[model samples]
Target: MSVLLVLPIVLPLLAAALAIIAYNHRTLQRIVAVGALIAVVADSVFLLLAVERDGVQSVQMGGWPAPLGITLVVDMFSALMLVISMVTVLSVLIYAIGQPGVDQDQPVFHPVYLVMTAGVALSFTTGDLFNLFVAYEITLAASYVLITLGGRREQIRSGMTYIIINLLASTLFVVGIAWVYAATGTVNMADLAVKIAQLPSGTQTALSMFLLVVFGIKAAIFPLFFWLPDSYPTARMPVTAVFAGLLTKVGVYSIIRTQTLLFPQHRPSTILLVCAGLTMVIGVLGAIAQNDMKRILSFHIVSQIGYMILGLGLFSVAGVAGTVFFIFHQIPVKTALFLATGLVEQSTGSTALSKVGGMIRRTPLVAALFLLAALSLAGIPPLSGFVGKLGIIQAGLSAGEYAIIGVSLVVSLLTLFSMIKIWNGVFLGTAEDPTLRLAASEGETRLATPLLMRGATVALVGVTLAIALFAGTLFDLSERAAQGLLDPSAYIEKVLG
Candidate 1:
């Protein structure tokens, strides 16, 4: 079982090397990339089952002991993250394979994509602070390549900003790690749990606030989030989709993991609640102000992140459960939405809402996919988004967090408004562009929406629907995972043993 924990991280790294070796053989590259992710997905499912049935799974690399070696562990939360992240990554790769320009001529895409997958797996499985930092560097370094893959002027411009901001966050993260390691004499997360609590109140408080800022920037929460909308909208659609789906969520996962493990609190923190509220309001407000599909969706990523953080902010079982379930809802839907928007872009040669219209006629299947995903994003009933939001709102109400709850409701409605704006502007409005009036196959050489792309999107939406249908079971798992976070004695014992 411990060896099972290493499989997810190792498989992708090995396949990435294979992909690089097959660089000139594009078919082999595709196989290596897709097959590697598929294997990861299967392994992750087994890992999740193993964790749920057994307990936290831990492994010390190179036959070394805990606190002195790289320890990788997975509880329910990290296991859930692994499963969903792999699905989203694999689905997007399929979409990219079908799209003509995405990875068609480029051999570097597959290897780099696999490297990013390995990095994400490492982030989920790492059991220590320094390894977490190393995992982040791995993920972000790959993202730097992915974001600027085409080397377009806009991509370089946006990627530079993205790179610079992430570098700042990385630097702060190092300082935070150094401070904690210096105080505790070890970076092992479970060990730090014991040592950090022994620190003086003032030191703990300072460390808590400092690391929150570091992760807040990485998670794109509130004022720290300005870089995301600017950075994501210019990338290739698959690149943007993967980034929107996985990267910020990794930061949010880190916040939940570290804050709960290293800086346990008995009650909700007002500072976190304030950040959550403002992140929601400001993000949706930014969404409403955007006319481009990519930019609008990008802002919503920041906004949706607030909901997850809000649940964590409550620092209660229900709240954390809500956060977990909302995260489950978010990963698939965000990826699906971006992919759908990509399809929309393919149909009309633009994601500008003002320029492209009447997609309902041009690409009926795509319009349906987009509408279903958009409705889910807006929290329409019985969809995964609604179930996720319901859990969060219900938990908040239970906690008597009335103000942020009100803000969340308002933000939900505003989210609907922006989705409607995209709906009306891109789907229902007149076909202002002649390109929008014709499918790529009909006459438009610059536009395309292949079946494989649509199939991949539909598969992700199915995952979203599956989440909605199985909401009760997932909520139970989330509660269990939350309980583990609130009481990590077992995790600590297992890691240190």
Candidate 2:
């Protein structure tokens, strides 16, 4: 059982190595990616069941014991994140294969993607603070390469800014780790949680706040989010889709983890609550200002990040549980919307609302998928997004944070307007160029939408619908995750035993 804990990270590393050697063979790359994705999905199922049946599972590395070795712990929270991350990456990988302009002959993209998967998995599983930092760098490095893959001018420019910002954040992370280690004399997360209480209050406050800012940078909090919109829109479609889906959330996850594990204090709570309110307001306004599909979605990512932080700020069982559920719901919906937008770009040659029109008539299936995801983003009923938002809002109101609640309400309403804005311009309005529409109708020159791409969209839409339909079970699972996080001795024991 413990051996199974390593498979998610190991499998991807192995697959990436094999794919690197088979770079010249597109078919081989495809097979490797599919195989890796299947293994990840299978691992996700096994982890979920293990947590369900046996409670949280932990594995200490190299036969060492707690506080002395690297540990991989799989609680309900980690397992669910693993599953959601797998689903998003797998779908994006499939969609990437279907993308029109991706050069499969270059092994760099697929291998880097696998490495990124491993990084996310490791970040979720690791019990050591330094190991988490290492995992983050591994993922960040891979993403940097992926962002700059095409060498387009915009990609290069955006990628440079992305690298600089992340590098600065990484430096801060290292400094925080050093400070934590100096104070606690150990780098293990579970150990730090225990020793943290014994530290001097000033030391604890400084270290914890420093760590929060570090994670906040990655999470794209209101003031720390300037790099997101500029950098996100410059990546290739699949790259942007996957990044939109998972990367920033890694930061959010870290914030939740650190707050719950090491700094469950009023100071962190107060700061996070204020940050959440501001993030919502700032992100939505950014969205309102964008006319491009990808850019708008990119800003909304920051907006939604606020919701997740709102849960963390409340520091209650319902709050954490709701946040966990929201993160899970957001991953697929965000990626699916990005993929739909990519398809629109593929067929219409632009993601600008002005350049894209009549998508509902031109590509009905893709348009439907986009609308479903957008509605989900807006927290509409009968979707997973609504369930998650309801939980968060209820938690917020119940906690008597009415101002935050009001802000959350405003953000949601503005989010709806932004969604409707895209919906009207791209799918409802007339195509600005009649000749382009005429060219679109001519079968001889019509852009061929691949079956894999369509299948991916259908599959993601199914996930969104299923999550909505089975929201009760999902929320319960998140509740269990929240409980596990609140009392992480089980995680520490498993990893360190």
Candidate 3:
């Protein structure tokens, strides 16, 4: 079981090495990347089951003791995250492989993508703050390459903004780590959970604030998300989907972990609630104002983040559980939407709402997929999004957080409106204008989307539906994860005993 925890992180690095060795052989690179992700998904599933059945799991590296040696730990939360992330990565890799020009333009894509997966895996499993920061750097470095793969002027410009912002976040993370270590005398999360409670109230609050700002920026919370709308929509489809699906969630996961484990006694719930409200309102409004599919989705990323943060801010069992379930729900829905839009872009040569229309007539499958995902994202009933939001709203109501509850409900409505805007602009109306018809015809005739791309996206759509169908079981797991987070004594014991 302990060994299984390392495989998710290690196998990807190994696959990356193999990919680099076989750089000239695209088929081999594809096989290696896909194989590695398959293995990671399997390992993550096993880890989730093992943790659920047994308990929290931990292993010390180099045979060193806890608080002194490097440590890896897995509870329901981390294991679930690992599973979803690996699954999403695999799906996106398939989508990328099927794209006509991806391999031709980016020979090193497989290796770098695998490295990024390794980084995300490492971040989820690492039991220390320093390693978490290291993991962020690893992921961010690969993202810098992936984001600017074609080196187009727009991509380079957006990548530069991404780089500068993330670099600042990284610096703050290091500073936060230093402060944590100085205040708590150890950087191990489990040990810090124990020691942090011993610190003076002022020091604890101050450290929590520092960490919050660092993660807030990473998570693209309100007022800190200026770079996301510009950066995400400029990247290629696969890159954008993966980033939307995974990257910001990592920051949200860290916030949940740290707030629950190290600072449970000193939660800054009020401030988080305020941020949550603002992030929700601001993000959705930005989405409503966007003219392009990718940019609208990008802004919604910021808005949807508010729901997760709302769960965290509520700081209760139901709230955290709702957040956990929401994370799982959002991952696939968002990724599928991105891939669906990618399909639209491939089929019509444009994601601009004004230029693309009548996609439902040309490619009903893509339009249907996008509609399902968009509806799910808008919190329609019987979908994972509705379930997650209902849980959070229920939790919020119980907690007397009426303000954020109002904000969240309004955001959901606005989210639906934005989705409708896209549906109307890109899928609904006629494209009878000669020039637009000619461009659509050329796009369909010359750049037809590959079956594999659609297949990968459909697979993600299936996952979202599965989440909805299995909502009871997944929500139970999330509740258990929230319980573990709310009371970290067992986790601390498992790591330190």
Candidate 4:
């Protein structure tokens, strides 16, 4: 089981090297990329089951003991995140494969994507603060490449902003890590948990706030989220979808891990709650103002992140459980929406609502996929999003957080309205051009979306429905994860003993 812990990170790195070596062989790159991601998914699932059955797993990198060596830890939370991240990457990779432009830029896309996958896996499992920073850098480096792959003016401009902001955030992260190590004499997370508790309250609070700011930037919390909408919408669809689905969640996960383990007794719940409310309100307002599908979804990412933070702010078992479940639900649903939008762009040469109308008449299946994913995102009933949102709201109510509850309800309504806006703008209105009445008709050469792309989008939609179907078991796993977070003694004992 401990050996399985390293496979997820190692496999992708090795695959990335292979991909670069076979850069000219596009077919081989595809096989290597998809095969590696599939292996990661399998490994992640096995780790999840193993953690559930036997408890938290840890591996020492060079066989040195903890507090002196690098460690990879896989509790329920980490394992669950790993599984979902891999699944999302795999789905997006399939979609990317069906895009010829992506293959035309094969040398850059394949290897960098694998490196990004590895980075995401490492970020979830690493037990040392420095390694977490390294994971983030690796992920961001790959993202810089992926986002600016074609060197289009908009992509390059947006990628520059993305790079500058993240570099600043990374600098802060390193400074914070250095400060922690200076204070504690150890960078190992579990060990730091014990040492941090011994520090003065003021010192601890300062450190906590510093790290929060670092991750808040990455997670795209209210004030720190300005870079996301601008940067995300300029990327190609597969790149945007992967970033939307996985990257911000990594930041949220880090916040959960650090807040739970290192500062359990001194959570900044009030601050987080305030930020959550503001993020929800501001993000949705931006979404409502957008006339483009990608921009709307990108802003919604900021809005949805607030729900997870809201759950975390509640600081209860149910709150953490809901946050975890919501992260899981949002990843697939959001990715599916982006993939559907990508299909729209490929078929209609635009994602602008004004340019791409009447998709319901031309491509009903794509419309259906987008509608299902949009409704799920808006927390419509019987979908995964609804289950996750209900849990969070109930938890907030239980905690007597009436203000946040009211805010959440308002946000959900706004989310639904934003979804409807996209629906009406993209699918409901009459086609802007009369000759483009039917999809793939001789007059509509540009409106032919590949079957493979549509299939991949449909597969992600199925994942969202499956989450709803298995909500009971998934929520139970999330609850157990939350319980572990609320009480980190078991994790500490395993990692530092």
Candidate 5:
């Protein structure tokens, strides 16, 4: 049974090799990629259920002892993250397949994308700090290929910024790992949790703050997040959609994992609260300023991350559970929004607010999809976003965190305003030119979005609604996960034993 723990990481990698071998046949490559993701999604659901049934599940690679051999672990949090992330990427892959033309190395796209998937799986499941770094590198390396896949001038420009920034973060991650190992005598997270508590209070605090910055940069939090809005908008819509949906969330997952486990202060963290406030305000403001559909969505990705950090700052089970639920909401909603924008670009030919309009008449289904996702993103009632924001706000109020909660409310309003800007500019108003000459087909008739693209977007939207409709069950799961995160003795024992 424990052997199944490795499948999440191994399946994509095995498929990636197969994808490379099938370069001569695009049909076979597509089959390989899609089939592997389906297996992963099924496996992820199994893992989540198993973790729920069985408590924390962990194993040592090559049968080595704890704190000596490689470890891979799955708790409620990891399992949930795995499930959501896999579902999101699967949607993005389907969306990518349906994109009829532009220019991308289709053969290489399959392998590189699967490698990124494996890296993301590793990030969620690895039990040690060093391997986590390895996971990040693997993900980043694949991303470097993906962001630049088409070799466009814009893609290359943004891809360079993305690469240089992540490389620096990767360097700092290594340094932080070195410091942790030198201080704690083990890189395994469960062991580090035990030993880190034994260190000098001063040392613990310093290490905590230092690693926060390292992962913060990766997570695109606050001042460190400047690279993201600029970087994400330039990639192919599918690439941007997947990156928006899953990659930064991986960083958030890292922060939640390491901070709760390694630090475990069990109270409000002033530093995290401050960072959250700043990230929320700044990111929304950036979104408001953007005239492009992709940029606006990209900026909101930064803003929404603040809420997750806000939940973490409260350092309570309720707060973290809210954070967990929010992560679930963000993964699909954000991906859906980006994809809707991609659809807009496809139909009208440009994402710039000044150039495109009246898409509601042209592509009503896509327009409806965009509005549903937009409203969800803005925390409207009865949607998944509303529930996530409410969970965090209630947690904050309970923790007497009124100031940050107020900031969050303001940010929510601002977020709604920016989303409205997109709706007005892209869907509601008249196009700057009715001819729609910018569309790929080169006539007044806009490009017809593929059935697969529409189907994939619909699937994601359905996921969001399902999350909202089943909020109670998901909240129960997130609360359980948060409880495990709060008191990780169960996690530590499962790993170290």
Candidate 6:
């Protein structure tokens, strides 16, 4: 259990070290990344199986007890998130190695990516509030570097906005932590949960609201989402994919964790509900207005986050479960689509809908993969997105939130329309150059060539189809994870005992 808890964080940290040491060697960096990804996948699988069979478990570092030493809790929810996160990282790693923008031998890129991965793993598993803060900082610092990796005028300008916004959010996070700790004497989440409700209602509410704003910024819900669209698109392809995949979801995870565990009876559902509705409406509108593929996807990320939070705001088991399920669906689909967009940009030298054209006539396989991913994003039937959206709508209707249901439905439709716009513009239009040929067939393939960037387009297309086909099994897993999160006393006792 301890091994499972630690391996996800440790694997990436060790890989980052190796990457730094092998800074000038592209092959070594790729080997380290692949090896670390394999270990992460294995660890996540082992932990997932262990939790399913034996229930929630926790491990205290250095063999010390909790409250005094750090602890990593592997509840069904955390374990499931761990698995999804690792899978996203592995996919993005393959995509990164394939993208021409990435300097695999760049001294800092691989190492920073590994650090970000480790930070995300730690953030999901940590049992203490201060530790969570530190984990978040680790992720943020790594991301700041990643957002500027290209160092282009646009990337830097966007990176500055990202850095400023996140730094402020981090400061607020610290302030909230101080208040929570001052109010309750300990920073262990389980302990805080037990103690928090005992505080005066006003105090509890204040703390809850404070944390909400802190995480709300991270989650990009409502007005707090302004930083996302401006910043995300400027990064390189794989960097954008990885950032799109994990960062906002981590924010949502924190919102879910803190709400369910520490403030189970906190009555901010109305506030959250209103925010979620607004977020979806505004985000999708932003997406519709964008011509850039990356910008459109970034806005959609904000919009989709609203759906997840709406599930959380409903404060029902099914709603929370639906959020979890959708989160699982969204991570891979979003990143894969972004990765596919990267390919389009790579081929056409642009991500703007106006600039990208005739992908089907040129790179048919890439076009197919993008279609699968985009259709899934639009929540089409028989795809994983449909399963997730159905759950949320079911939860909303059951709770009698017709307005939410209506808005969500409208959002879904508009989302489909927006996706189609991209499809028509980028895939179906006349070829941009009318002379561009496939990169792989034009040149010789080598042993070290990145597959997904080159011939692996077909393979990625297959993987996306597989995810769409296996929606049932994944939905069930997410349901179980949500149930575990809603009743975390079992998790608390197992970890602290």
Q: What TM-score would every model get versus the actual structure?
A: 0.97, 0.98, 0.98, 0.98, 0.97, 0.95
Which ranges in model 4 have alpha carbons more than 4 Å from their true place?
Answer: 433-445
Off by over 4 Å in 3: 442-444
Residue range 52-113, candidate 5, lDDT tens digits: 99999998999998899889999999998999999999999999999876224457898999
CA displacement after TM-score superposition, residue 426 of candidate 2 (Å):
0.2
Candidate 2 clashing pairs? none
Q: Give me the displacement of residue 257 in model 6, in angstroms.
A: 0.4
Please report the candidate that would top lDDT against the real structure: 4
Model 4: what TM-score? 0.98
Weakest lDDT window of 10 consecutive positions for candidate 1: 432-441
lDDT of 2 at 472: 96
> Candidate 3 lDDT, tens digit per residue, 129-172?
89999999999999999999999999999999999999999998
Candidate 6 structure quality by residue, lDDT tens digits, 11-38 = 9999999988988888888889889988
lDDT of each: 0.90, 0.89, 0.92, 0.92, 0.91, 0.85
Query: Which regions in candidate 6 have their CA more than 4 angstroms from the true location?
Result: 431-450, 454-464
Report the C-alpha displacement of residue 210, candidate 6, in angstroms: 0.8
